[model samples]
Target: DVAFLLLTFFILTTEFKQPDVEDIVTPSSISKSKLTEGDNTMTISVTKDGRYYFSPTNNPSQRVELLEKMGEKYNITFTEQEKTAFQNTQFVGVPVAQLKAFLQLPEDQRKKYKGSIPMDSANTQLVEWVQNNAKINREAKLAVKGDGGASYDKFKVLFEGLRDIEFYKFVLVTTEE
Candidate 1:
């Protein structure tokens, strides 16, 4: 009876982890401290090629609200169905101009999307996102997971943007060596 119960537990608990939207080989750190799983944590994934993706933890309602708030700020509109889809999405990497269409696509198709949110002078979308997200979720703490090979130049603008917005407290997500 015990053996049968153990087998059932193993079968129920085994699960496959999904692949990340972008590949990030985080730099190793001497300190092995783990980041606590805070309720209002937001993560920014940065790839070696300098792309960015954003995700917030565990709250579907907040996720949908973020989409709606961004739409209001950008003068864009999203249908109810699209907002529902965005709420279920694990992370977002596309630009606002393409977000409506991107959200409309099926999950499989969204995984195929390779675009990143713009971070340049002409389109500082990520900065805008961080600011709005902070306002909406006042306790949200940002965790930036940057690839080891990503350039400092790629990070400088984001740092400056955070500084300008007075968002100085952030975590650098890294691997422990």
Candidate 2:
């Protein structure tokens, strides 16, 4: 039946929101301007504790390539199956060293994986992750979704990381009342 096929198509194509998606309360804003969505946006979610999670783009191939680049940089090799798992992940917060084990977990457990990419001066993995992803898609836009309770200092550090890579402009995800 055409109607059955149509419903199946929609279900297969829809990307379900991750149930354990980062728990962050974005500050409310009244701005009318909106950032364009789709594969062009690369979002970094910051929790109240200042933990940084790199959210992959909606494109699965792009996400896989992004993970590959990160793995190569950290001297960690990811198998084909692990790469596939990484692509399907909603967001990755673990350090490069732990990425392999993180990806190997079952889907439900992967969602429970708790980690954060290092964004400090000594680590700089955060900038590397963004840089590699940007290389994959030159048109990608950067955005930060910070917790409402997160301190300005945490945000300042994140901005500085982006600045080191010559990125000055970015969207701030906010909730509208």
Best lDDT goes to which candidate?
2
Give per-model TM-scores: 0.89, 0.87
Model 2, 10-92: lDDT tens per residue? 99999775443568999999988887767778889898888889876778888888888888787888999998898788787
All candidates' lDDT scores?
Answer: 0.83, 0.85
Report the error of model 2 at residue 82, Å.
Answer: 0.5
Residue 9, model 2: lDDT of 100
Candidate number of the best TM-score: 1
Prediction 2 global C-alpha lDDT: 0.85
List the candidate 1 regions with Cα displacement exceeding 4 Å: 3-7, 10-18
Q: List the residue pairs that clash in candidate 2.
A: none
> Please, what's the RMSD in Å of model 2?
2.9
Worst 10 residues of 1 by lDDT: 14-23
